[model samples]
Target chain A: MSQKIEFENILRRIEEISENSKKIYGAPLIIDPKTGVATWYDQREIKIRFLISIEKIKRFFEALSRGKILATKCVNTGEIMFPPQINCPRDPKNQIEWVEIPNEGELVTWTIIKVKPYSFSHHDDYIVGIAKISNLNINILAWVKCKDPNKLRPGLRVRLNIVKREPENYLIYQLEPLEEC
Target chain B: MRRKVAIVGTGHSIYGVRNDVNLPELAYESIKEAVDEAKIGLDDIDLVVVGNVGGWSSEYLPAIVINEYADLAGKSTFRIEAACATGSAAIKTAVDAIASGEADIALVVGVEKMNESLTPVVVEFIGRSGNYFWEFQNFGLTFPGYYALYATYYMFNYGVKEEDLCLIAVKNHHYASMNPKAHFQRKITVDECMKSRYIAWPLKLYDSCPISDGSASIILASEEIATKITDTPIWIEAIGSASDTSNITRRKDFTGLYAARKAASEAYKKARLDPGEITRHLDLAEVHDCFTIAEIMAYEDLGFAKRGEGVKLIREGQTYIGGLIPVNLSGGLKAKGHPIAATGVGMAVEIARQLWNKIERGRQAPIKNGRGLAHNVGGTGHYAYVTIYSLTKPRG
Candidate 1:
């Protein structure tokens, strides 16, 4: 069962047990199905989400929408950063500038995520991979659009493609394997 | 002036689902055993260090809650987290305290209640351990998926087959069968491991460690106090720790953990042992076999074998007891159970038991060198800690 449905079923059972337990025991008591161990079900349910600030590197997101992937480069040290950073730690006076990542690369490693997290369980199995961009020291991690993962191998040539990820529609870059190496 | 520290007592709880007890109650089980074994009371311990990486678990301040339940209230207590290596970090913290004369007697407890939450929720929490925004948030990489990335690259580079990885699971399960406290007590065949469903490509269900709920504890004291407490005190010869970038993409290589190599080298230098022939100097090892690929990588990173030759070691059955080096005699995290933060302390307890010949007969190593090693890694090699335990006191 999907985690969402499984969780709902559990909550429903807990609610039913609480209704009976509250009348007799005056608490949310439960017994585990597998172990038959008694437990006190927590009444409060909390949901959490993070509000991360990307104000310093907002240009990277803006560039993503415009069909360009951007990385930060230290102007003084000539250092390139993917998943870009605004500051260069090598020197105090160094300024960071946005640079575009190359469209071509070779697959360094990949894994088909058969067992996904609770949040991603809604979707089918996906292949997550890391590819080293052409002529660049930096590597990028993204979902690889491949029909057969068995055909995927390290050193296989791939090209970057920016597309909208559905259900949670947003622009993200992915890798598409080239026909010829 | 640095002082010598020794583990005077060790305790391990039955590792499995453990739905019978709450967090503190589970922790108290090991704490009581360790205290009794040390012949000490709660009042005897000067400091307490708890290791727990809590996201799926309910307790936020686990150290205080656990201490309060164990009747250790008002004690100098704190919790340390280094992802899965939290247990080793706790032991290291307590060792530092005793070594620095900050406390003469200290208690270290590593516990995790991973089953408190649903498996999917726990999976989500561990998957977010890496560079969350870059790797997990976009790709939704599970913990097994992260290790599978390494398995893919390593197998491609070294020509290791899936059967070679299955051998590791098979070997660990064989040893876990003899360990009463281990989560998996039944021995498994290579055919069984191969038939298991894959959690990630190249990593099957048997390759991965179970999300376990358990606790392990150790009591450390200065040399003067340790000699008085127990005659078979396991000396803390050396503990070396290092870290790597949180982003997996930035790693120099995926074949093996660089941090583990650095930590192992540092540990060898501290212990004054040769890395080239490290297996000869130690009786056995308890590596962080959270995944089978991890154990293979550990062999190379810890200098047990040359680069890309780790696969050969497993194929030749060189890691089993009566071979070059017996590894994961307590079944490792693969079969013993990985209770997150509790795993490192559990490793220490296993090594200590092995060194003292206190463990069950079939899985015990013949302690010829009077030494054993524990290699614990956290979060896809984001953190690494290598600890050496010896029956002999260090001259340094």
Candidate 2:
């Protein structure tokens, strides 16, 4: 009953407003059904789709496709960079090389997302965790494939795994508990 | 050498879901009050600094819109953004302008009309505040989810139960009940907070601060002008600001905000007070309580309690009027209403009023030490500002 009412209300409101407007006048007047408040809906709709240039770090995606996580290493300072950047801020002129991240690490923190944002409303509750990879001297953020948060601890041993995400069949990385269940 | 700055006049609008007033009208409410209290005309103002986070609001360029409506247009003005701490950053900008002898009197306004957008859209905007591509893009972490990470970790580490967190909600709401301008003026019980549905694991609905629309303004003057304007001017003794990595993944711990700790240390150092012994010097504080877990962390981060013992302070009623150092007498952002950008400036207005003994009967903190503190954190510890206000003039 709730779903049917919601569908009818949405369709009725959209049609009522759109039928009166011939052209976008930078103003879209729509009365809120819940509050009956007259609200000027923004006619200028912005669709943000960034064509991010990953040409410099193309190897990261290439490595991800082959089930591997990659990090950039500064040749001068030997510092590792996750979310691999092309240029090293510490040593601007120094040469940098892409290196594979070690799989073994420790879970630093984790949270189960009960409420989701508008863009991520479709997905079920998921666990997001941060793992400290000792060799790289940095932490990586990824989904944790765990059932219960009670079993998770700050110093628990975990491993980073590159897997194909379901529904989308996209390459993504996740953290898994290394200890036997 | 730079000149010292002081808050000569401060004004705040009623904070709530203000659907009655438009953006410009809402902003003018505080601006007019501030100007009147300062005994200054529009011509007396040299610069205007506006703090507004505009994604959820209708006006894209609020600084100019507000200036035009207030009839202070054509004067030098600019908007500043530091997430939720935008108000403090705006004040800092105006302070620097006055301190450098560029402007003698500057007006700083912090306003946010969050109710302009729907609740879900606002949630989407706030959730994307931290490292958008990394955090929100994949995981779809809500604002409550970010704090829930700390809530879960703190509860597990310190053995603090969910009731302890609910107690904070009850206390803030109690104070809010007395505050006519508070968003949620009705008192709540721990049982009610416990019964509230979970927005995030371990963080129920009551654990979060409401999304509100409000405006606050303060007129800052140079020491020379401040002394002439008001006999009880609240001096901006010291301000410490710091930033952390954009990515939450890069942070070392989730139990407490590192940026807040760093900012507090810097502020205490400038005030010539020890970071570990700040409670001894301060009369009261208005720390950012955007979430119940945040307030608990602020207690430790601001040196009001030992690490992991913040929950004990809440459980013991140590942050009340007669306790060691009272906090959030203004009902805090939790119950007083967090209008995002308006909150930090609203804290300044509240502290200045507290220093002047102009607050209501029951909520006022005794001004024995003649000092107060305001800790405003932007994003999830991405930026932190610790501002100290004093009754007496600061020495070189």
Candidate 3:
């Protein structure tokens, strides 16, 4: 199943219109018949795909494969770092250790992504939540598995779990409400 | 000792899905106005700093294209980006150049052509602004979704209703209707705003600023040159900026922006003004209302209201003219339109004109203190800038 009208459909429509206009005008120039405003339709397109360097904190990804979430803790300052860093900000000389983040945390905030980005258009509306890991003093942002967001509120207890995201089938974390489970 | 800087001229183009003009033509629209207003030719400009975040637009080298188009090819020019706060960053660079005696007069132009690509593509590019690897690559947070999280937390913690947020949209549109250059020229009711479709849960489509294409420019000069340029010059009082963690999850709180709070305090301290009583020192403010919740957060962050009391200010209409303190009198980013890079410079231009009482009749704030404020934030408060402008020269 697909969206009733995918965004790609709209792009196709513009391309069709541009092709027809190009035949008559000898260019991909479009004149908004309604407003009489002239516009040149760009013929070229660039698809961006980034290959980010994740070599330094490879342990974080390795821990994801082991069904565990990891964060960094500076041994010198006793401070926890999320999105686990390779070096400590306070003092790079300080030794850091990888620690498993707590599965259960309190939901601090949440929202349902009604209008998604172009890349995320295939997916249905999703709920994203942020939770605070009290012990480590760090928060994690993830998709909250819920349909009734009306029932969700701040301070609601949520537990994080590593699972294979469907379609892509990649290891990712999600937040699940305590009551629902 | 640093030389004082002043804005001798300012310019702004009409904000909307501008299919009428391309990047250089649009940039020149403001540049021409700014140059004409300063009573100086392009040859007088020693430096040109352009603010443009281009992924959706066709131009890769916007500064180079603009310099050649505007006939400033010989001038020192470069592009700057601080997410949506690129315009302020451009001004900061120009001001630094003038203050350092490197340039006597500088022209800072901020322009964005967001409508070059389709809306969906534009949405995707903007959504990827903050922490791309952890946030967007995995979770996929749109610009509205990022702010909606804060709105959810604020609503849950402070007992704020969705109607309270709609009030912000209603007020901004009301001012926008009065502003000739605003994207939305029609006033909207709170009921109308509430009935609008939700772009992100807790944030309606009306609650968010439009994808705008526009340009704004300002000519900055040192005290000696500023005196000769114009009779009425808006002095650059103070510019305070700060940044936060790219990852939203790393933030300790979500109710208000921490970086904005830090920037406001820094700006007030530098101006020798009390941060707590910001409303008393400035006649008006043009806050980064990228979304409705953002305006409310700005209130608390700018010390217009205490924590959790931002909703009350909106409900009481304190931000409107004749209220406790007027904010967004020029419709703000919410309705004036957010052309990303152009927004901060547009705010500066609007505030400068407002301070001189040269703007349109209906939307001008009463200039009681001869001062104004522009609060521009980028990427979910990851980058924050608070710029203070004054009619009178500041004493050391």
DockQ per candidate: 0.83, 0.52, 0.88
The collision pairs in model 2 are: none
Better of 1 and 2 by lDDT: 1
Identify the candidate with maximal lDDT: 1
In model 1, state the lDDT of residue A80: 89
How do the residues B59-141 of candidate 3 rate in per-residue lDDT, one tens digit apiece?
A: 99999999999989978989999998999988988998998999999999999999998887888999998899999988879
In candidate 1, how many Å is residue A154 off?
Answer: 0.9
Model 3 global lDDT (CA atoms, 0 to 1): 0.91
Most accurate candidate by TM-score: 3
lDDT of 3 by residue, A128-157 (tens): 889998888888899998878888877899
Stretches of candidate 1 off by over 4 Å are A1-26
**Candidate 2 lDDT by residue in tens digits, B1-396:** 889999988889999988778888889888988999999889999999999998888788999999999999999999999999999999999999999999999999999999887666688899988888767776677788788877877887888899999988998998888877789988899999999988877788898999899999999999999999999989999999999988887777878999999999999988898787889898899999998999999999998889999988999999988988888988999999999989999999999998888898899888998999999999989999999999989999
DockQ for candidate 2, C-alpha atoms: 0.52
lDDT of 2 by residue, A8-127 (tens): 575577656854543554346665557765556555667666786778888998988888889999999998888788888889786899899999999877777766665665566788
Model 1 steric clash pairs: none
Q: Which ranges in model 2 have alpha carbons more than 4 Å from their true place?
A: A1-38, A166-169, A179-181
Ranking by DockQ: 3, 1, 2
- Which consecutive 10 residues in model 3 chain B have the weakest lDDT in total? B324-333
